[model samples]
Every structure is written in C-alpha cells, then in structure tokens.
Target: MSIQMEDCLLSYKTALMAVGAAAAYYIIRWFLWQLTVGDYDRKYVFVTGCDSGFGKLLAKRLDSLGFHVFAGCLTEKGVTDLQTGSSGRFKAILLDVTKSEDIAMAVKIVKENIPPGTGLWSLVNNAGISGPLGFPDCFTRKHYEQVLDVNMYGVIDMTNAFLPLLREANGRIINVASVLGRISIRTCIPYTISKHAVEAYSDGLRRSLRSQKVSVHILEPGLFKTELFNLDLIMKNIYKDFDAAPAETQEYYGRKCLKDFTWVVKLMGFASSQFHKVVNSHVHAITAKYPKYRYLVGYDAHCYFWPLMYLPEWISDFCLDIEFVPPAGAQKKKNN
Candidate 1:
C-alpha cells in the first residue's frame, strides 16, 4: 500500500477513536447527572416568588419530595393557599422581594424555622415582574428600577442575607434568569436588562463563593405560561405607559405604533405551557449531587434563543429587528 493511503487510514482510525471517547465521556456525564442527594428531610430550600408560577410550583414539589421548604409569597392569599393543605414542613411567609423590610422579615422567619443542624440547602431567587413593554424612552428610570429591584437587586440581597446559612450547609443558589439575558429585545428593555444583570451576577457569585463551598446555578428559561407573560395584563400596562408619554413623544410614535404591539402577542404565542420543565430544572439544581452550573430550560431556549445567542452580532441584531415593532418616527429619522 502507498504511504499516503496508509496515512489516510490512520487519520480515519484516529477520528473514530476520538468520536468513541467523546461518546463515552458524555454517557458517563449523563449518568452522573442523574445522581441526587438522599437526605431530603434534612435539606431545607428557600424559594422566593411563591405567590404564583414556577416558585409556587417548585415549593409544592420540594415539599412533596420531603424537603423543608420556605416559600416567600407576596400576598396573604398566597400565604394562606400554600399553608392550607400543605405539610408542616412547608411554611409560606409574605415576602415582596422589592422591599427591604420584607426581605429582613423573611430572613428572621427562615432562621427561626430551619431544622436543627442543617442550614438552607438551596435559595431559589424567582420573584420578578415584567416591566413596561414599550419603547425604551417611553418609560423613566423608575420604571427600570422597579423591575431591577426585583429581578437583579432582589437576588443580590437574598444571597447576601442567606450566605451564612448556605456556607454552613455547603449549599447552592439557584437564580432564575431568562434567555433574554443572553439576547436582548427592543420591546422588553427593562426585563432584558435585569436578566442580563442576573447572568453577570450569578457568574461572579459562583466564582467568589467557591471557597465558601456555595455553588451558584442560573436557570435561563425561555418564555413560559407564567404570570410575567400575561398577555392582556401586559398590553394594558404598555398602553398605559404609552398614554402617559409626553404629547410630543406620542405624536412622534403615532397611535399606529400601538397596533404594532401585536408583536408581543405573536411572541407570547410561542410560550410553552409545560411548567414542569422549569420546576424540574429547579429541583435538579437543588437535589442533584452534581448539578449543572447553568440550566437552560424549555424548547425555545435550547433550540432557538440559545443558538441565536452565539451568532454574529449583526445576524443577531437582524433576527431581533424582525421581531421589534419600530416607532412611527423611526422611519422619519431614517429618511433624514
């Protein structure tokens, strides 16, 4: 056989070996990922935003799995509902993440309630609000601050308040971000900004807490049937903000642009009704002996938003532009 042909055969064999090794590595990882902590009753989890959505669902789930759960709710009804038929292990405290008093009160309640010896096993920062969904300039700094207070700063405050407990248990922090953190959209500027901040904060916290034996994981879920995606409520808020805009700003944008807010409806049409994906991701992040540092949940997150995040900046901008509804004045500015 010719020397060149032998070299080619050798290269083929090397590629096959590499493929086999890669396959084996992933298979082992998949198996190990399924391993979970056995002491459910000893593990305590604190989950915020239990008033509704993923937070509420996860609280119930962990309770069923025998973990002592501290569910931070925003309303009396939220507190009453969870405590009504739930196990004694499930305690719901009225907690609005935006308020310093609420957070401090919650910290006291958690400290008072935690079982003897075990510290908090997980802290899930899930409370968030969908900010005004209109043009960026249509809202003020206060508008942005409202959302950030819950989504970004709230996470920071919760983590800081509970770090001592987490360090004691060598526990983990599971923050709920969004795919929007990786890719920004024009209409949801405040929400996008907050999630992006969360991504950065989670990364930094994960690194900083390594010595403390505190693992930080982030969940970047795509759109889902959560309160944050309530369409009618969202539209109402958007139009409210639009109406409040200065007269000149309104004239420039034109009422016609409000019609384009249909883009939000279309976008939300893709929201998955499978709440379990997010809830399960939270459970895994809490219970799995070797949980992933980042959990990207939902079909849209895995198949579309995550992939789009890696594309060239121009390409991503183009894709996002296709979804953005421009203001009436945008054309005039472009023409000039």
Candidate 2:
C-alpha cells in the first residue's frame, strides 16, 4: 500500500473504535437507567407542597404510574381542586409544613391507609416560597424568618417526621434544592441560606441513611415558571417590602435600587415554562435502579449555573458583582 493509504486506514480504524466505545458506554448507561422499581402499585408516596407547582404535577404523574399517592396541600381550595382533577388514585392531606400538628396529621393519614409492610415509597419536598425581595437591609428579621420557615424548616420537619415510614419501605427522599442553593446570587439571602442548608442536610441524610437502603437525591433545577416565579406577585412583594422600610433606608438605597430590582424580575421573563423536567427527575429518583445523587435539570442549570458554581470565589465575585453598576444612591456616594 502507498504511505497515504496506510495513514488513512489507521485514522479510519481509530475513529471507528472511538464510536464503538461511545456507543457501548451509552448502552450500559441506558440499562442502568431502567426502572427497577418495587411494587409501586402497592407502595405509598407522600409529596408535600402539592397544592401547586411541581409538587401538584408530580403527584399526578406518580398517580398515573400506579403509585398510591399522598399529596400534602396547604389550602382547602388547593386540596379540593387537586382531588377533583386526579383519577382517585391519590389522596390529599392538608399539610402546612410550618405547623407541627399538620405534619403529625399528615404522617397519621399516610400510615392509616396502607398495610404495615407497604411503607412509604418517596418523600418529595417541593413546597417553597420566594419570600420578600430587596437588598438585605430592605427587609426585617421577621421577613427572613417567614422564608426559612417554609423553605428550610419545613423540609427538615417533614423529613424527620416521615423518616420511619421511608425506613420501613427502604425508599427514597428527593429534596428540591435549586442552583441558587449552590451559588449565592445578588439578592435572595434567606432563600440562598435555606437551600444551602438543604443541600448540606441532604448530603448528611444520604450518607447516614445508606445502610438503611433509603436512597436520597437532590433535584437542582434552574429558573422555571411557577407560582414562585409569578411576575405580579414578585413585583407586588418588591414594592410592599421595600416601600415599607423607613424613609432613611429608602433614601440610602435610592429609587435606582427599585429599578434594578425590577430589572432582575424582568430578566426572568424568559425562564422556562415547563415543569416536566423537574417532575421527570422526581420520577426517576423514585423508580430508577440506581438514580443519580444530583439531577441538574434545564439547559441553564447544566450550561451556566453548574460551571459558575465551581469557579473560585474571587473570580465569581468579580463576574457576579464587582463589574455590575451600583444603585443610584451608592453611585452618588462613591462620587462624593
């Protein structure tokens, strides 16, 4: 053979080998991804924050798949509506996660329905609030408390209450943490703290519960439209929280803070409207033979937020904060 022909054959062989290797890896992964689910038809799943958003949709998703679903909703209206819409495979419990009595009642409700051995299949912590928005000083300690109560403490209280049932079934706990949980953002301190705490708590729970065979997974999804992202509610809260501050505080921050804050809200105008991505992750975490420890859903989550999370602190700070312009008051102060 001529020298060029030999070289061409060698290159073709290398490319073929790479393709074969890639195809084999994906096939193995596909097998592992198959549902090795237990008797879901008989098993029970308790999902909180099902009154709306991802939780509501997930409860429906699991119900359709044959699991006896226990949905925890925060309001009578939500409960009534969810029940009316579902196929009678799922039951709704009035669960205000901040209330200990409510949590106890939810536990009792789920336990009473199933036989002793069936036990709970999954606990999805999906209820959360956006809380009041502003620079940290614009809100009070009470404001922070309210956000933590639902987003962070609610998850803890609910998990602790249901751990025994999950242990009995050797099931799964899927906690919904966000990209914000991994990396702090411009505002949203209380939310960031709560989610970060959740990430830490989930890590600890996963390690400790391994011997019990209760797998724990964390779902981190980027911006998506839900009540949490409702623009009217967001803008209303912004004015309500920030406007209520003392005159001095408002002047210090200036009118421009409000403008920039609204800008941030508007930026979310393009956030994904689909909730299926997160719900699908929830389903996999429950049914897959060996589910992932962390599922990063959405393009924004995988392409941007994940990488930004690992950047060095100084670099991220500059990228996220320093280059950005300050509010009008801060700018004036700098000049003076």
TM-score of 2: 0.90
lDDT of 2 at 193: 83
* Candidate 2 segments whose C-alpha is farther than 4 A from its true place: 1-26, 322-324
Give each prediction's root-mean-square deviation over alpha carbons. Answer: 1.5, 3.0
Question: Which candidate comes out best when scored by lDDT?
Answer: 1
Relative to the unseen true structure, what is the Cα RMSD of model 1? 1.5
Q: Candidate 1's error at 13, in angstroms?
A: 1.0
Clashing pairs in 2: none
TM-score of each: 0.96, 0.90
Instruction: Say which candidate scores most in TM-score.
Output: 1
Candidate 1 Cα errors over 4 Å, as ranges: 323-325, 333-336
